[model samples]
Target: MTAIDWADYATGDKNAASRTLLMREFLRRAALWVDHLGGSERWPFFDIAERVDSSVRADPDLLERLDEFTNANVPEFIARRMCRAAVHWAELRESTEVTLPDLPDPYEPLIVLYERGGVFFVENGVADFEMRRVPLRTWQANLAPEPVVEIDQAVLDAANEEVH
Candidate 1:
């Protein structure tokens, strides 16, 4: 039997919690990168690396731009790489009779607390008719919430502009 090297198989961590925390940090960094890129109207994470890399190669003065672009697109690139590394690590660990700990996430209830508008906002709380005393007998006097499909960041931005 070949001697198993636990250190070689492990991805710098054997604790499932540490692995999860690392993944969460990666995703958080990715989100921040996307948000920063969005500020410059650079979004959708398509060919960002190539665009920035080629641009920087043509003009070295745009190194900062290249840095920001890579930082913004790190999530898309790093996630796949990390996943492959984790899988390879797990396979190696499994072969050495190392039992993987159960990563039980008992925070299902907490999900509602961290819910965002687009994903977790429930429409059930919205009423078909206005709750106010104003009566609408005609077709034009009706009040209803806009369809979800038509509501987006642009709509929100327009509403916010009026507030300021």
Candidate 2:
């Protein structure tokens, strides 16, 4: 499980501690949803994006906090992508004509969560390295060795004698 210092995101905004807590809870739920849906690669981001939009719309204060965090922590391009994704998700949900934008890559806790779960996010749906060309057998051959058990010789002899 990922441990977050809520204060880091809040940035000394003690007045909105409750909002910060709410955001933290929402993120925890979102992380759980990601795990349930098979990590970042297979994550149904459209659904989550819509939720993010709705949550933000419901609480302007939360939006303020989120914007602050995003500006401070997220890269400009990635923050723009996130905003676009929220708009795209809203369009899809409302059945508006879709203008397909580049999907937003996971950031922060999400990146760490998915990585820990053994799923990596590739930008533009393309891996930088030629992982596909590597043969399965070759990959298997490079796997770590299996575990070995150590048994005392005297214990083994005692067991054998008792069996006899």
> What lDDT is obtained when candidate 2 is compared to the true structure?
0.34
Identify the candidate with maximal lDDT: 2
Candidate 2: lDDT of 33?
Answer: 42
TM-score of each: 0.23, 0.28
lDDT of each: 0.27, 0.34
User: Between which residue pairs do clashes occur in model 1?
Assistant: none
Deviation (Å) of 162 in candidate 1: 50
* Tens-digit per-residue lDDT, 73-154, candidate 1: 4333432233233333334333434333332211211121111110111134221111211121222222122221122334
The alpha-carbon deviation from the true structure for residue 11 of candidate 1, after best TM-score superposition, in angstroms, is 7.6
Model 2, stretches more than 4 Å misplaced?
1-16, 41-78, 96-164
How big is the RMSD of model 2?
18.0
- Worst lDDT run of 10 residues, candidate 2, spans 127-136
